[model samples]
Target: MSLPKSNLQKIIQVSCAIIVSEDRKILVTQRSASMSLPLKWEFPGGKIEKEESPEQTIVREIKEELNIEISMSNKLPSVTHHYENFSIILIPFICKIEHGEIKLSEHQAFRWLNPNKLLDLDWAEADIPVAQYYLQTLNK
Candidate 1:
């Protein structure tokens, strides 16, 4: 089934980060119990605000959500996903932590896991492709 015209026109663009640590682990955050899609693991990120570039969105979101600074390294393929009530264009970028300890304000938990182990968690649907791409291209 397809969405109605009104709903189809309401796609949200989100900027997501695939943060890699010095030890080669990828960072993942769990949604807080009160948040939409609660407790699902996902790459930490947020919706892009008006007039903001995806890169800027990621930088700002990481600071606000994780309380850490990141330097974007590369842009990954973007994924668009549809749900019952909405759709999202997930733009992912590779980033490295530049400063500060992570202090989660919106997430319930966080983990640094090997790329190969990313699928072990119960991931949010929109982030599955991002994880798969990382695993497939890790050595490239």
Candidate 2:
């Protein structure tokens, strides 16, 4: 019932991004003190589980982490980053808020910043490229 050995070796991790905006500012979240990269700000998202599509993962992650619902849209470019412990292929989506006030369940704080100002903050290493793309494409 299982796939071949070649397929077994591949490890695919999934996550999502909620590109929330009001007027021109976008929401960004800070990783919690208990997290590995604590205090560094990141787009709110979490690990995608089995039996869910990327779109479903995005919705679930946002709700779980931010206590808000999002309308999943088209895919954004996937970014890959390697850390000392593990690497992740982050599939970020361009999403809009559907409902609920954002309540931080797993972070220190959240900010609504102009996309250009995104670069000014101390970002988690993995989020840098995604931030750059967001600023370049969405800020203007």
Candidate 3:
């Protein structure tokens, strides 16, 4: 029998920001053509660097990638997915923009989408479960 994904020897830890607006829309970004998983849409955040907590990573990444500061509101359930060559555990947090206008620097495109319509885009595999969980939370 194969090992459970959690038992994988090299699982990567990634942080995700679910930037929600007062109107219930969430920010989403599409990967640049030169990035891995090119063209797949994902939430704005990045890999957790050494010595940085998931929270710190999101704050720093959002500023660097979108030029905005955000306040974390809640922690969503984390999702783990196995790709062809690796696996990742995505830790998601609900966030609100604290200041500054967004100016995308790493993504090819971005959108403010109603939560219900998020699945309409082609999402990176790791984000699929996180999006589903976020949507389910809205129904409860």
Candidate 4:
């Protein structure tokens, strides 16, 4: 039997950053073991709050999750992926670290990897497309 509309999965919107360093490396974070997709690497950011724009969401998420400030540059293509239980739209922006050091609050670890090396890590399924896009567009 088909599920009720209320029981259907919802599409979540998340704002992520492709944080570029002075040397042009991209920042990726590993999910905490307690998190749903534990130990998988993904770009740093979080779900958008109500009334928040994608830009605002990314800035706030970076501050909250990484304790660093970032200057946003251009936006990349958004990725939408579906899992068995839910779907998510990943909104990614190109950004540079503006200030502060990396401090992990919710993540297990962080890495600054060459864009070409991004695929070497085990990534969250939703974030794979983002990494591939960055590699294809920016790493060329």
The Cα error of candidate 4 at residue 81, in Å, is 0.7
- lDDT agreement of model 3 with the native: 0.94
The TM-score of candidate 1 is 0.94
Q: For each candidate, how many residue pairs have backbone atoms clashing (under 3 Å)?
A: 0, 0, 0, 0
Q: Report each candidate's C-alpha RMSD, comma-separated, in the order given.
A: 2.3, 4.2, 3.0, 2.1
Better of 2 and 3 by TM-score: 3
Tens-place lDDT per residue, model 3, 1-140, is: 99997666677999999999988899999999999899999998998999999999999999999999999989998888888778899999999999999999999999999987999999999999899999999999
lDDT of 2 by residue, 28-127 (tens): 8998889989899988887778888777887888998889888866677888887766777788887788899988888999988876688999988888
lDDT of 4 by residue, 1-140 (tens): 99988678889999999999999999999999999788999999999999999999999999999999999988999999987788999999999999999999999999999887999999999999998888888645
Distance from true position, residue 112, model 4, in Å? 0.6
lDDT of 1 by residue, 40-125 (tens): 99999999999999999999999999999999889999999987777889999999999999999999999999888999999989
lDDT of all predictions: 0.94, 0.79, 0.94, 0.93
Candidate 4 error regions (>4 Å): 1-7
lDDT of 3 at 89: 93
Q: Extract clashing residue pairs from model 1.
A: none
